[model samples]
Target chain A: MSVLTLEDVNSYYGNSHILFDLDLEVEQNEVVALLGRNGAGKTTTLRTITGTVPRREGRIEFRGEDIADDSVDKISNRGVKLVPEERRIFPTLTVTENMQVARDMSSGNPRDIQEMYDVFPVLDELRENRGRNLSGGEQQMLSVARALIQDPDLLLLDEPTEGLAPVIVDDLYDVLSEVVAEDVTVVITEQNVDFALELSERAYIIEKGANAWGGTVDELNEREDLLDEYLSVGGAEAD
Target chain B: MVSLGLVFDQLITGLTIGARLFLIAVGLSLIFGVLDVLNFAHGVLYMIGAYAALWAIGAVSIPFIGLLGIGFWPGLVVAILAAGLVGVLIEAGFIRRVYDREPLDQLLLTFAFVLMLTDVVKTTFGSGSNVVDPPGLLAGSLTLTSSLSLPNYRAFVILMSIVVLAAIFVVLQTTNVGRLVRATSSDRDMAALLGVNVPRLYTVVFFVGAALAGLGGALAVPTQSITPALGNQVIINAFVIAVIGGLGSFAGAFVGAYLVGISIAVGSLIVAGAGQLIPFIAMIVVLLLKPEGLFGGAEA
Candidate 1:
């Protein structure tokens, strides 16, 4: 069964229609990437699933249960967790304390902290540092680690490599690859098409809140004209 | 010999007054931090507590010390529960809808509530300033001598406050629920996304915060008069302490209470009725330098 499914979803912010008949699904353990240019509602889709962006209409089913109107907490407790776009780490809390807050909330195993430290060794090195003190790459990693503490089944990552140095991006992607390999379903939204192309099993291109194109990663690579036409990336289709 | 004794006497006096401030300021601070609601009616809750304690004493028709286990303990428990219930009702009927609304709206609503509560209590209890003296067993002065002595009740109030503050500190520092309180206060929306039952936590915090305020008032009954305007004096004074400590900071509130309490106590010793001005002045200075608070960051 798919871990998450958005069936004929429609959402609006005030009078502005932001999402229109959005249909998507993520099978368990698959890495699906939503790639788009700015204002394409890439972030909104993730937020809607997370319930950070309010839902006006649609069925958001998780693990075969209908939880369309449930609050973010309930949805999260059911195992879908979102790592927000800006990496909303608690500025006032230390890295360890941030982990502790998540630990306090859920049935987190004590051993998970060690596993998280292993996932991001840099975080272990800076465990005592305040969230505000971490660099962008470090904060992104910490954000992921924070979500892991919740023991989520489906992890929604928003722009995990937005402003990292090349080496840091490499490190982050390596961590992402390792995580996705371990039976955790990941849906990453990125402006970095190359990473999405290489890492994701399936890809969707959205424009102004609706899916413009979707295909398997190999099929997506074959459609160079599709990329140029929909994603505005130069013709991988023609090439 | 007398002068040295009086200084010791004054130090003891400072602790009693500090307890009263602790009861008032921390209540306001907790509600302000978690609900982001200033609870203008806190003084009214205090007044209710004092009056309720008075009622417990009379209604039970028992000796005062006997009242501690019987009238006093039961009365205190009832007072906290009743006040906490009222806080929940107010939040449910009015506050929940206005969470995303402006603070000014909440301020006006709570202010109106203060007026309603004060008038209601005044009408029911009458405007008379009722006082409950220490029970005879606890009444006699503890000697610094033939001329000077301290009432055992006031000393008890001080000791009880230290115990209460210690308990509050332990709960906030160590408990899981307390951590949830801090999380919600720090970021309500973020807390919700993280799977915290935010609305439920909101109601619970409001109840507990109100209960503390009410308990403070009830505990103060033996020492002060129970009048309609009692909440007014309590709120104004607590606001100063809350500001001095940094709004919503539990630790800051605790220290602020003692500091402001000491300031007022010392002020009254020399300046008489004008000592209250010290808190106002201290509040203004703290506001100027540390707007976020003494320990916390800028208010969200």
Candidate 2:
């Protein structure tokens, strides 16, 4: 069953159009990657689903409910969690406090604090540390852990592996792969093709606010010209 | 060195005044922090609180509260609740519409509220000085040292201010709701995505800020005379304190209030107009030395 679907979504900042006729879908337990270079509407597409984009024209269905007109908080309460590109951690708050703020109390979320620590043991070490004190990798882990604490069914992560060391990326891939095991659908936007392909089963290449291609990771690996045309990355050998 | 007794006396006086300033300025800082709006009408709330207390105490009797024997404590309580209610109305009726607009727009809108409030006070109480006698327990002075005789009301105001400060600190620092507020203040959009009701939070913040202003006004009624333009005279100093401490910082407000209070208390002893000039001078110096004020970091 499709867990999330966006049909002909168009988003804009004032008069400047960012997403044009963007259509995407994710099945239950699937990992989907929205791949594009900078300013190609990948982030905007995720933001549209999260209801952060101000001017959005489209139909967004999460599970079976249409959430096109819902406010950001209402959309979030419906179990759609977005770990934004900025991460948006409260710099003044401790790591545990950050996680606590996103707890899904409405669903009586069974995910405990220790469960989150089990996923990112680094968070356990830095539990009392404030968000401002965390390193980039630690911040990313905390960001993902915070969303996980919400026990969301559909997790929208923007540029999860950006500016991270390979080892940290590997660790994150392991954590998310485990999350995917529990039937949670994840839609991630990325410029890192290797990282995206490693986690995502299906990939959609968005170019200039429209869908350029949609296929499996294997199909994307064979099309060097498609990668070069859309992502500015050379090909499979680029990784 | 100057006599230690004289310095001690001035310090006590500074603290009493600082307590009142903290009450007003902290609310200003909090409103700015969470709402990202500079409320020029905050001073007007202070003015309303003073008048409300005066009405409650039978100093100036309107139709509703003048006939009752609502003494000092009840009067102050009424003033705070009334001011907070007015704030809720203002935030819902006016400020909510301008939340996403420019700061200039918010400023002008709040400034309009200030004018309207001032006019309402003038129409109701007339343009005369209204004084509220201290409560019976706080009316007299208690002699401390040979030269240190503290007015009981002033001491009470200072002590009460400390209690309020501690309460606010505990609320913002320790509670779950406080955590939500702090998170919202850091990033409104992110807070919403975490299922925080941002609009309701904004209203609560506005109400709390207004209530603090009202409490400050009621406290000031015993120490100073209430005039329609009392808000105008005090607001500039409150802004100076908020800026000198950092616009949205709680600790900054606490320290900045004392700095401005002590400077004014000490400066007035030296020169004729130094009390007024020192606060502005301190603000300029702080701006020159630490552009973000003492406690302000990257958020400034």
Candidate 3:
């Protein structure tokens, strides 16, 4: 069974229709990437699953329960966390406070944020620093680490590596792999198709708000023609 | 040149006024910081508290202190509840619908409510001014200098303000609920996913903010006469304080309040006309330079 499922979800912003009957799912211990170009509703898909944007007509089920109408706070307390686009870390708060804020959300004991810091050793060095002071890569690491401390059942990350150095990309991949090993399910939306594929075991590609293709990482790797046609990356020979 | 005693008198008066501004401005900062709404009708909420206290004390028979205690205390509590209820009604009925609307539309709605509330008080209370005398225990004057005397009520207001700040500090810095409140203000949607009851929190925050305004009005009634427009003069000052302190910075509110308080006091002594506008001038400079108040970081 899927850990997180969105069935026929439709989301609207005022009169504008952004998400149209989109269906997606993430299974236990799986890293699934939602890939699309700008304005393709990738962010909205993540928001809808987490109940940030109102779903006009759809059902969102997480971990065997219907949670479409549940409050975002309620949905999150059930161990679902979202690291929003733009690395929405409280820039005013120190790394420790930001983590504490996330930890304080649920009623129980918080997950060990140290393990996250251990994975992103740079963040451990800058724990006393404000989130804004950190480089783009460090802020993204803080965002991911803060979410992990919640011991989330399903994690939603949007554009985790939109603007980062090449070296930071390797660090993010390491963290993503470690997260899945802890039995956490992840659904990440990414504009960087290469970066997403490096970390995600499964992939869903969309164009203009509709699901264009859905398959495993190996299938996407083999189908270079499909990637070149939709994502404009490269065909089979480009590698 | 004034003597040492004269300076002390002004210092005491400054503390009283500073504390009052702090209580009122802190709420304004919190409301604005979290939702980014200006709450133009905040003054009306204050007026409601003053009028509520007047009615409660007049209708119910009690001793002066009891009237002072139960009157302003209970009346302030009720006013806060009423203001919060009104806030929820406004939010659910109007603000909620305009959550995504342009800022101007929301401002216009709140401005309209301000006018409506002012009219409501004018019709109910008439144009007459009402004054609730301080309880005899808190009525006497403190003879700080041979000639200068300070009212006990003013001192009480100052003490209560400090107490209120201390309590809020405990909650915001140490408690779980306080942490949740801070987190939500930082990133609301993420806070929700972390299991914060945001709508309920919004309602609570609105009510608390309204209550603080109401409490300000109730406290003011003993020292000053109450009228429909009594809150109007104070609200702008409170806004200036909130802006100078940086909308959501709790400690910033105190800094802004005392800075403005001392400036206004000292300004009047130097140049009465310009002194009154010192806070505004300071605000102008602040916005021009920082735009975000002293303590506000990126959220500013």
Candidate 4:
């Protein structure tokens, strides 16, 4: 029941090798988190799976089909949506327009707009406001809402909680919990250890560009030395 | 007191020229904004449109159900369609390859297309300047003042351009397709993640942009000289307008067209040959003052 599997995947940026023999998997409706400090290849792993970062070697399978050579748009067509770290929202477009455009691009009957509004009422209140006018937290919400409207079978979120207020991060955690309840498989990369552990069922600690270790969230919580050496702190919100 | 009538005449002339410039420059701006491709062949697309209209009307005329051959209107339609189709083909065949290449590579690729397109037109139509009469409905002059008169065709061109502008605005602002276009133009990577087929969208945008340029060329038939170098003649000025307005900016193109057009018109009035230099000066001034161009701060 593995919805996505990246086996011994290697990725590069120009000549510099980024991800090295990275291995990961997400099961049906499973919530998995990739945790590491900056430059640990967590983001690159998510990108490789989404086909944004070209994998130099190994296999990436989604729904039991290899997708290592598939184009970014093609992978997206197979219901893989990525909310990147930068939260690249169209600043000139209104909030509603951003979500509507995503919904229009996806196949099948449109997801109910009311459901989106209900999930993020702040988005509804600022529906007519342009993307540039939104605060950082609001932009993050809009970015996440855009991906959600696509109704993807596999959601890839990279650093969704990066640079957000603790309160906003808590709100995002709540929204994502609701999303998980809807049975969409998610693979999120995070530097905030507590936040990642709070949402994900399992954790993979990435060291440099390869997988260092992975186990259940409870198992990760028990390994204080492993967390300290890779994630910079033994406990708490150490990135 | 001399008279305000001459000034009115010049204003009307300026508007006509601005409308034509807007047509060519808007497409250039759109292409740059979305695809990040500086299409040098856009001017040639305009030239192709002019030549296509001429050939459609005079050389190879299509027989209507009842009429013997096609007229100027049908020829104009053909010219637009031909230019748009050619744009799509070029985008798919040549420009698409350079999207991921260096900026210089893209410029060189498009510049090569320009040279090839120019030679093709020269070979097909000969290098000599030609003329095509305006449609009968627009074949006269309208007397706007006691001493001022406007060519009916120029008036028609201005009005038609306004309608096209309104349509473009409506499509980009108030429609779902426009939202997708805006989204794609804003961030292609993000749009792709949203499941937008960006390559196909790019092709459509290039087609629309080329078609607009072609329409401008067709409209110029009765007003401007038809020659192989016609594209070379107006393209620099069009680039200046796009730069002054801001590359990839709709409102920038709109305002830049008029700024350049009116400067040329009024400059001609003040000094003999200053009209030619005015647009460049305006471009330099805009660049020095606001490096992003007037409307280039963000894509619309």
Worst 10 residues of 1 chain B by lDDT: B60-69
lDDT per residue as tens, model 2, B1-300: 567777777777788779888888888998999899898888889889888888878788664534445788998899899889998899989999999899999999999998898998898778899776799978888988777788889889888878887888899888888888888999899999888879999999999999999999999888888999998877888899987999898888888888888888877777856887998988999899998888886342
Off by over 4 Å in 1: A107-111, A230-239, B1-14, B59-69, B135-138, B145-148, B288-300
* Local accuracy of candidate 1 as per-residue lDDT tens digits, A1-239: 89999988888777788988888899998999998777788888988887877545889888988878988888777777788888888776778877777777664343377788988999999988987889998999988888887777888999888888999999988988888888789899887788777779998888778988887999989988877776767535321
Model 3: CA > 4 A from native: A13-21, A37-39, A54-59, A69-71, A107-109, A191-195, A235-239, B1-15, B59-93, B242-252, B255-300
True contacts kept of each: 0.50, 0.70, 0.76, 0.84
CAPRI band for model 2: medium
lDDT of 3: 0.77
Tens digit of lDDT per residue, candidate 2, span A51-71? 999889988898878999999
TM-score of each: 0.90, 0.93, 0.84, 0.93
The candidate, 1 or 4, that scores higher on lDDT is: 4
Q: How many steric overlaps does candidate 1 have?
A: 5
- In the predicted model 1, the residue pairs found to clash are A224-A236, A224-A237, A225-A237, B43-B231, B67-B72
lDDT of 3 by residue, A1-239 (tens): 88988788888876778887788878888999898777888998887777787655687898889988877777788888888888888776788888888777745557776776777788889988987698889899988888888877788889988888988988788878777777778888876788788778999887777788899999999998777777777534322
lDDT tens string, model 1, B34-104? 78887888877777777667677663222333333346666777778767777788887888888877989
DockQ values of all predictions: 0.52, 0.54, 0.55, 0.75
Ranking by lDDT: 2, 4, 1, 3
- Residue B148 in candidate 4 has what lDDT? 84
